[model samples]
Target: METNNTKMFTEMFSEFENDAEEGQKQKIEEINEILDEMDEAEFYSIFTKEMFEKIDQMIEKKKLTLENAILLLKHIGYHNVIVKFFKFDFHVSSLRFRIENMITEEEKKKEGKNEKPLVDLCECNLLLSNGFISEPIISVCVTYVLKVAMSKEEGEEARKDVEMALLALSNTMYYFIEQKLYLKEIKDIVQYHQEHRNLTRLAYQSVWQFLFCRLLCDRRLEDVILNKLQFEREAIRELEELTKCIDWKKNEDKLKEMEEENLLERWIIALNIYFKEFQIRKKEHVVLIECIVQIYQASRSNYIEICNLCICLLKVILIRKNAEIEDLLKGGAVEAVLEEIQRPTLDDEMVYHILMFFVNASRRLKEEERKEMKRKVFEKLEEEGYEDTIASLFETFDFLNRKYYDELSLDISNYFVNI
Candidate 1:
């Protein structure tokens, strides 16, 4: 007796082999209806690797239209939510063949053959964009595509393959992290692209976004990414070496120059992840605080999002109380916050966080330290006309009726009172 899956596969294959497009569409729809009614185990039984090989054979023989093939993959991809231990080797291999053939067609087109490839590149991209495909399948496909992309020599053909690979990687990155598949090759490729400046602007942005998503989910990658960005060991070494021979004023200039040399885009990506996904570890507090303060100072005017994230992360650090206030103060956190408030378009959320940072930092300081902090802040405020800045911010917070407006306002006012 044939199982339900075996029976459906028989019918689907029969319909696929038919010459009439309407018959094929009808058969596909009937099979889709059957698949829609089946549960995970049933779907798994019908969509196995052997089944995909059969479909690939049909695809090769020109028996199934690209639309039919894509529809079948779409169903499998959509039902990916329930199936476990999915056998995707055949499908991935088929996809690799399609992509390579598409590139070959692209090269041929340049040489005067206007023939399009049998597979639809856009449909393939859309299929991967479902965001439901399993990591193993995506990993295999991405590995193959990136290998092709990197190995190709400089030419239009290489650029097209690279663009296709980047788009596919971007679409599948969400699943990559969701399924906890951290491919080291992907990390290496993203890092290489960052330095090479070879990809188009859109592709460049896509790969960086892919790295950002991966970093957000994998806590184990934190140190690796930070070290690459020089926010860990290298940053500490540089700071130590700079302090050996320089006064604070000259040190500030040297640090600013060093920070300028680093990529602002990378800093923004790492900081966004640090702010949203994970807390900075205690050991990272000193270096990260210095890094955040410097970047905030460098970007306060031009990059509002980075500045906002910097302030929010600083607030987290202060509330956790893992780092000493002296470290924050000496790292120029106070000056960064002051300069941030001077921005003309400060939102209520930003204002609330900025005030909260001050409130949290001054909470448990010693009396002498409090006095010194107040004197230092007041001098800066007086010199920069930040007295009016604070007052205006207070009025905005008061109008917004933010939950901690009263507490934050009083704490900041008391903390900065002139002696």
Candidate 2:
């Protein structure tokens, strides 16, 4: 079987190398002309392995040197050939099935020299302290591996690789952005992440990570003032292309490892990086605030995280003094926070945060929009049979100047320049 397998692949390679277009003399001659001029070594820049063991070894050693392949191709300086290989537009799945079956029969040939047919990413963390271009390409391959896992019906395993690749992609992409300082690509990446509204419950919180990672893609994504974070991707050019990627794997084991060491808080603190680096626009800034609001309002998580989120929102709303915030109250932001506070037996701390959320919301409104909102609130009250409640609430906040100004001592370095 092993001999047969070797013979089969050898035949395929020979056939591919020396294949003819049977009916077309012109086409056959063209292929010949190209092959005749080829530097065999450079053409085999991405060498195929007869043994999966060798490929697995390279991947395990973290020495699957695409460097040599990259260098060899660069030496050949033939972009057309490389482009032609990738641009062939083969459906990945059909080709993958073809490869899988072929690899399977070949694997069965080896006696007692086998492990798992698929490489174990968990056993080997393929991290490289590497370059910008290398990073994105690695991410592209990581995503491919994850797809393979998913196709094998290992969603849990696939998610782990996806997340790993995401982190790698982040490291790589930022390096590229920093190197090129290409504002257009940066913004495009940002917009792509922003447009990915992860409706999955896990995504809402993870969205900020997406923003923080991408912010450093071109311009930094942190805020110095208020020592905060924001996600503004208006600088990237082809965001749709960048963000068209699938979500990273959720490595539950990783989540558990981090949780044991109280690292989850640090994860939340990543938002501070974004808050510090990018100029948080009104809409983007409010998203962080609103995410916190929604999380707490759901009354689903533990008290500690909810409290931390409330406190952060308090600081953000106080510092920003945004005008577009009235829309949140309109969109039930007020109601959500209020619901959290009034949950069966509400505590004083929670109540205090709820009031602060209101105070911040009030400060965020423009005087005119506030009045219109105020008038609408009363109308809404009438519509809802709560006209009496409207009057009381309106009278309560009428004196209502409770917004915060940016602290005078705030350092510009601490805040991201909108550039």
Candidate 3:
């Protein structure tokens, strides 16, 4: 018993087979219209693995051209209203079969075996950007794109392929993270770009997106990513460069440019993730602490977002027992906190985290070290006129009835006063 949806699909497939080239535009419109009219269950029933296999078979038999097939898929992909209602299984095996065939055909053409390539670069790009969303589909697309992007083939066409592959990968990267797939391959691609430095502007952005996703998804890969790539050193160097170049008070344009680059943001996020599970080493501890203090010393008016991020990272570092409080004091952590607290327009959340950094630093310390830390913190506070800052914050919290801020403020006050 053929349902109306299946019958409609059959009619459309026949039209695609019979007039693969001549009436593709009309057929595509008709197909989209049919899809738009169907309900979710009907749409799924008509567009299943078997249907994809049939399309694949048609391409194999020369009844449907690869270009037309890609066009059809693109239109279907753009059917956002219909697509949002159901999880459209992308029929990965069939798509893989078509892609493999296309690759094989290209190889044959390279060997002077075929007159016309079955699939050209434009069609390949179109197929890849078809908005396929399933895990298996994304995995296949990513694997294919990485292979092509890393291939030795040279020319404008090859470069276009690499660019297109990167665009496709960027679109699917979050899905890759959610599925937790292809960690090593993504790492290799990033490392490849790092060594080569050949990616275009857009491609470079996409690669960084991949790297950031890899950093956030897997904790076990942190050592390999950070050490092999020297990411922390690179991040510190970039931060130092920005601090030298831009006057935070008068360089809004420069800051916007840096924000667009996003290299620092990626590094900060990766470092935050890395420090969550692992203790900071002596070397990283020293450099990162110095880096934070430098940023604080330079920028009080602008870069508050980056400032807040650094403070949060410091909070994480301070929570771990292995981070020596004495090193923090020596590295000017106290001064950095005071600088941030003294900002004219401090938010409640930022204040809470700053106070909590002090709380965490003082936790589990030896009595002698605790008193020493208290002495250093209080001296810095008094030197910077922090009493007025605390008084103002207390009044704000009391007016707003922010209990969390009240509690955290009291904890830091008690910790320092008891010493």
Candidate 4:
């Protein structure tokens, strides 16, 4: 397979290199078809050191267009060749310089020819997707697109060109988030466009997609939240600004609004990350609990998912060895869970997490305190029309109960009987 693929790829390149203008469309189509059918192993088999050097030489000799070189790089550099081959950096650097020069050339060209390089450079951006291209190159592309977006062009042709550039940049945004060298500038560009130009909707969304892409791609998604710890004094201030940016009350009132904002879901995701990754410090704990409780209380009907998340966040925080469980109780966290569980729309998930919250909070207390808290919780449940739910708690399987309370789980289970 290796020898066959190598021979085929080498022959195709030989044909293209020997006659640059002969059957250009046919050759490009043939190259695309062959590349489409080639899998990772077959590709690696054919793309050798000699082929990379030859392509580099062709670019340096001006025998092949930079566009064609980019195409070749896309095919040969698949499956992390850029990362594996040190020599590929030369090709990458050359491509970067070409793209920068293209940007400069586009700036100097009149309207008629300006779109030509935009189309070509857009091709370069698409080829640079995956992991083959370096961050510096993508940063250069992003910086160029952002500059185009920022320039105050007056005519219709210029505006259309700028929009095209933004759309092109949006197409490549998934590749842009890996580099932080220009992230702040990229964000400021997006924010500026969002604030200053209603016409830049496409550009703004592309930059926003960059952030969402980073969140999806990052394995440690909570690191953003964890980094906030360093700014403890300003944490609440920052959170307040975030909270005020959206009208939560309006969101609570309308389903469409809630779905659009999805603020609670985003907040819960952050909380879950902090719950899993970091110890809940006193200040962080207080702020988180207060935030959760406030969001839960202010939330209206059909918010079981958010309610359950708040309960789970509470449960995780309560279980922490250094947790100030008293702060949660003082903030009416118990009442919030109890209220949510007794709501007519409650589901198994909500009940389960809330019950886990009780079990966890109970185990951390002294025997007398545990019994007292359990008694109060059951009384509240019964008063809130949750007597049957309380009974079901005792009848639940031991494994589920023990998972939260160990041996004390049985005692807690039995205590439900008397209530």
Candidate 5:
């Protein structure tokens, strides 16, 4: 079987399909050799310089200046080389200041404390922004250490390295996902990060970093993945686990984990998912219902989530209570949903949703709403109704149509022809 590192490389290469294999292989090999004698970062600078030089030479031959060649290559896809060059090892460009501050803070710990003053952190930051095609570089950077944590011998020190690497990886990936080049890579890293809880700091870092990345990733990714992003999901569960590598003596990391484990984070995730739905269709009222369902099931205990849940619940009651679902049937919305939910051998969960949908139909009732509904039904039945009454019934029925449980069993073949 391929090792975890090999597997990660495979995942990263999944994109850039026509990757000049011979070229990239020769490139990484030549780059690695040069890096071996110098620094891993040398690979990033050298490869970038060499490739761009050659591209510039070619462009210059065509009479284009170096800057124009660079710009044109970016527009025409040679930017992949720069992206690949980042795959080696990415040290945080700004962690020194942050680490120093954190170290100083550690020295001033209130009382008895065991927080290690990050003796030394291998600085790795690849100044990535959300506007470039650098997702693959992110994948390669993060997976380097994760592969070790997942496969190399199990040890505490190795785990800390893994955790730190992952934090930096996740930090970089936020920029990658925002850049919109490699979701397949982000998904892979998320899975790896969630797999085990190493240092409390690392574990919390992975979760926060991932949640942050998810917030920044392609809205389309969440659009399709909304239902599947749950931590309970195997693919996610496999990566979302907390390993035993964290240094809990550091109260900060432990506190961070505790904070993230609460429900407020989930509320944000749910909100993110629903926002994407709204983006796709502005008047998709059904999304409100869907959002509520997700929020209700989310076992979040954070007060912020609870408050948000309360607000969302109020919205649900406002929209759904005393809703007139009858006109919705006539308006074609009800028919559209029934057609999908009425499938044979429906999944149990979906069936439960249908049952609850009807149950909700029975609740949220208002006496005036019912009277108005009855008046509309009678008017529809009476062929003797005046023009005013006819218009009123149409409007009234549409309101009721939103909450009514009546089914529209259009013949399947007729449904196709009518459409």
Candidate 6:
């Protein structure tokens, strides 16, 4: 039985060693069938050092796709292989670099050819998604991409390289963040691109793509943002500059080039997710929190859809227990909510979101912070000459808190009664 198995493995490897594309598909199919029939333990037992050396030779000779190599490893239950590498303290960086190089070659060949350029990219993504790729492999790819992106004189080829790398990193960021590998590098890359005014649009947007992936996968990215960017004050200034840099004409040109709408809104959604996921209440986030409040204030006058989004976002943010609300109060968040709640044509649902902000803030914040927030809320309402409105809204808040039903009607009624 051992002789037969060894002979079969040797035959399979021999078939793949052929230089001709002719009969390759059939050979691959045959190989797949043979692998499928083999038990996992039996397959794993065949991964001798000689087999890896042969595979490495095939890879070096451009005789194998990284995807197929990965699939083979996966089929053989690659965990033990990784464990062995770890045990021996093998340097896997060269192997990872080879895979990265293979993917880049494939991408370049894809331009005019029908063959898929990013097959390796997709394969790496799949491996990472399945939690199979080793940490060392991930680090190689991420570090390479960051190096390309942060270079002072990146040309067109470098730009393409960085974009592909960023997209791959974006997809795999969850795993990297979870393992806490190379986080400072990612932070530095994002901060440099975000702070630099003259980077390519792709370079700037790549950071947001990275952020979006991290937000989807891990909330702790908020800690990275806070510590790395000091986001509260920086977010405000960044946003102000970002908004000011928008030229309608240039925006239209960008839309034409990218064939996508709502590019600016992507940033908004990412920020909203970060704010929603981690409820840290530090003063650092207050500038951003207040900016959201101001955005709500400005949009309410003309853009109801944006106004609704802002209110809903604020509702999510108010759930954080951190002392961040003090800045919101100082920034006039209460007044913004009050004004929006009493808007003539506002939807009851929007009002409900605004009220829920208060309810959540009351629940999530420390007692003293919540009380101070409440006091400031009322004081701001009075300052805005909405004392009577505050009384009606408070009653509505109580009714909703007590009955916990008729929330929609209560919100609507409160708005009208306040008016």
Per-residue lDDT of model 5, residues 1-419, tens digit only: 44443344334333323344344444334333322233334334433434434443443454443233223332212112112234521122222233234444544578864332222211132222222323334444343334432433358776655554444444344453443333454455445544653334433334444544555544555443444444223222222232122222333553344433332333334344333333332223343333333333332232223324423332333334322354332333232233323333334333333334433433443556445543543444244434443343234333343544534222221121222
Clashing pairs in model 1, backbone N/Cα/C closer than 3 A: none
Pairs of residues clashing in candidate 6: 232-284, 281-322
Residue 377's lDDT within candidate 5 is: 38
- Report, for every candidate in turn, its global Cα lDDT versus the true structure: 0.57, 0.36, 0.59, 0.54, 0.36, 0.53
| Rank list by lDDT | 3, 1, 4, 6, 5, 2
Tell me model 4's lDDT, rounded to 2 decimals: 0.54
lDDT of 5 at 164: 47
Identify the superior model by TM-score, candidate 5 or candidate 6.
Answer: 6
Q: Write the per-residue lDDT of candidate 6 for residues 340-360, one digit (tens) a residue.
A: 766756554664577666665
Candidate 1, run of 10 with poorest lDDT? 114-123
- The list of candidate 4 runs beyond 4 A from truth reads 1-256, 300-302, 320-322, 393-419
Q: Which residue pairs clash in candidate 3? A: none
In the range 1-419, model 4's lDDT, one tens digit per residue, is 55554566667777775666545435655675566445556665555545555665777787777666655544443323212222233334444455556655665676665554455464455334334444545555565555565556667777655654544454442453554644555545544553566333334334433444444456443344235223233334434544455455454444334423343354455456445545646556667577777767655354555556667777777776435667777777777876766675655555567666766776666777666666776777678556566555545546554554544344444534332
Query: lDDT of model 6 at residue 403?
Result: 53
Candidate 2 lDDT over residue span 1-419, tens digit each: 23433344334434432333342233333433343333334333322322223333433454433222122222222222211223221122232223344334434465753233322221122222222133333333333333322221235654444443333333332332332332333333334444652122122223344345556554543341123322233211112221222112223453332222222332335444544453334554444455545444432344355345544544444445442465466445554554453243444444445445544555566777556645644444355455343233334232332333212112211111110
Task: Estimate the TM-score for candidate 5.
Answer: 0.29
- Tell me the number of clashing residue pairs for each predicted model: 0, 28, 0, 0, 37, 2
Please say which candidate is ahead in TM-score: 2 or 3. 3
lDDT of 1 by residue, 219-312 (tens): 6666655566433443344333433332322244633433222224333444455445544555656676787776666556555655687787
| Candidate 3 lDDT over residue span 102-185, tens digit each | 555554454565312333322243233334444444454455556655654557777666655554455443343533445566
Cα RMSD for candidates in order: 15.9, 20.5, 11.6, 13.1, 21.1, 15.2
Q: How far is candidate 3 from the true structure (C-alpha RMSD, Å)?
A: 11.6
